[model samples]
Target: MVLDIIFLMLISSTSHVSANSTTVLPAAAAACSNGECQLRDECSTDRDCAAGLYCLSCPLEFRGSRCVRSTISDPFKLLNNSLPFNKYAFLTTHNSFAIRGEPSHTGVPRFTPANQEDTVTQQLNHGVRALMLDTYEFKDGIWLCHSFKGKCHDFTAFEPAMDTLKEIKAFMSANPSEILTLILEDHVEAPYELSRLFRSSGLDKYWFPVSKMPRDGQDWPLVKDMVANNQRLIVFTSDRSKQETERIAYQWNFMVETQCECFLFSCCFHLWIGL
Candidate 1:
């Protein structure tokens, strides 16, 4: 096995080190035979390294100090460090008003409020940045319904979609550093109505225009950059017809998701094996 020697370059806390400068550690505290380790390197344990940077023992995969950064990474940490939004393995969730309660790849959501404990505001307070909402035209008003079985059932959960949008708008205003993604299980007959709701809800200002989007699976803009430009919100609907108009993005175009067929097959295969 090849040992990749790690080098540590440390300058005095009160002084700067130039290319020609050299400082030596006392012989008693040095652990590295090659004389490269400073305060933190070639460690017997992780306490030698600075806070948050665990020591990486070369080659072997082990617990604690024996860890290596070559293959290990937390995408969420990367995201916080200003990787593009599309690079986030983590997402924002929103718990605004809705009956859809999120769904599977098959677009199926529970109509009975199963597992629907938090309202949209509560979800937002708890760091949820994604919202799964259902949109419908009901009773002469645009409402969010827990539509199941091919129709919006009156007995299921329901609320005005605008009310929820208001909550999201307020949250965004209060938390300027945060970002959100809206996933709509769109069932409204008029594709343009989605635009009207967004506009009226005061969310149109935060809309990310299609023209700025990267094409062909290209990288998305950085989250900080998006926030700085006030394009901190992402909206996606299942309705394809509504896309590229009034800034309501289509989910199929934006999300690289597993097809419904493949997802179902994988689930069924797992179930069969479990049995």
Candidate 2:
């Protein structure tokens, strides 16, 4: 079963990598109509908006999109980082690698649908704590893809899995207080390849061992403890057998998931509903 949501993280600290990172909220920007627009203020470009917002347009909603909140509340930072890992909610991006305007491979324009408009690094900077990635064994290696008929053709492939994992590694290094979860829709048939991929990406240093995961319904380790130990990366694979063979956490054994299929707001959406 290919899961639609993969990783979750406790976003507690800011990264120095974001060029637009700022905490200042100018008082005059609220009234200005030309530039430096605040929330609910009119804007024409992303630069015209404040730090955490961007100019957006919706054909059905009025005429244009106003500055809206893009960052999620950090429970760890708001209260404390000592709480159990599962005690806080996280923001997740579905099919994060199916990015819009991604350059085509195989010298052919991609016909597959795109699921995201920003890069993985941008999503992380914007407080997206989780990412859903579809991994398949293609072209002799694991690649991020939008699987069709359970196969990853050249047209559907996004990029090598290592690229995104390296991005995560860089983000983790820049923000030491954060904890991330990666949920993999495992289609890779190669034995132990997943383990190698993480190691090669330099993410192995932060791997959260499966032995530490709770089998029964129980609280996870404190966010502070995970950061201190540097076991900040939690990975889950859909393939059940990997739990034993590759030492990767089998997602279903730990949590219950229901993928939301509806795209419209009026349509019913499924929830995680807990373990």
Candidate 3:
């Protein structure tokens, strides 16, 4: 009876060992097939992976064989240390009033706010890269704010606008890998006041333009000074005359030659360049 009990015990122990070995073998093989022993956790591509391993996707700001994080400190670092001057342009499609003719107008037209928003959305959807908004418009023989033009709209004060501008600047600072190029088009405004407003708003870092032709007496010295101070600002002349066009071409060519950035007239009818 004692000999029979010993034989039964030996059989039970052998069976247990066999079951454990069967369970462990597949797991060990899987680990080996995944290259976990050799590559550890670092992998770039599927080719770098073993039979059971696969590639994983990385963040948008990152680019590498292994989908590793990027080393770039800032996301919005401008390419070539300058904005693409003439690569894009835009023309405002919606007027303050409903009336729409050409982009340039002598008086404010009646336009619904909802319609303007819808138009902006459509332009954005149709690969419109930029938008130009007439911040101030000449109406009733007086200059009126386009944002609040024909309606009793509750608008943010200048201080709040400045604060919002700071927040935007902070966001850009945080996301340096992202691109945020805004061109402020000052339509028939005093350069000094516009520059002051931008500076107060903490948006002086962006490229801004003051229209030159309509305000004839103004000098380019302010623009030059702004540019010299590492502020991206340019002078824009309307396409009024053949001589003017030639002058623009010459000035544009000089800017290009000197590696200075400037915007040009765009072919797209509805799009306008803006900040």
* lDDT value, residue 199 of candidate 2: 85
* Clashes (N, CA, C under 3 Å) per candidate: 8, 4, 21
lDDT of 1 by residue, 1-275 (tens): 11211111111122222232233423343454332334334455455544434455423223223322222233434447376666454323322353244333224333454323456776666445666677877656677775575456555545677888999999999987777777788888865787888899998888877667665646677777988899877777877877655456776565533112222111110000000
TM-score top scorer: 2
Computed on alpha carbons, the lDDT of every model, listed in order, comes to 0.55, 0.73, 0.29
Ranking by lDDT: 2, 1, 3
Question: What lDDT does candidate 1 reach at residue 155?
Answer: 55
TM-score of 3: 0.28
Candidate 3 C-alpha error for residue 180, in Å? 4.6
What lDDT is obtained when candidate 2 is compared to the true structure? 0.73
Ranking by TM-score: 2, 1, 3
Q: Tens digits of per-residue lDDT for model 3 on 126-233?
A: 222222233332332212234443332223111122333454456545533222322232343333443354467665554343332112222222322333444342
Question: Candidate 1: lDDT of 171?
Answer: 96
Model 1: C-alpha RMSD to truth? Answer: 16.4
What TM-score does each of the candidates earn?
0.59, 0.82, 0.28
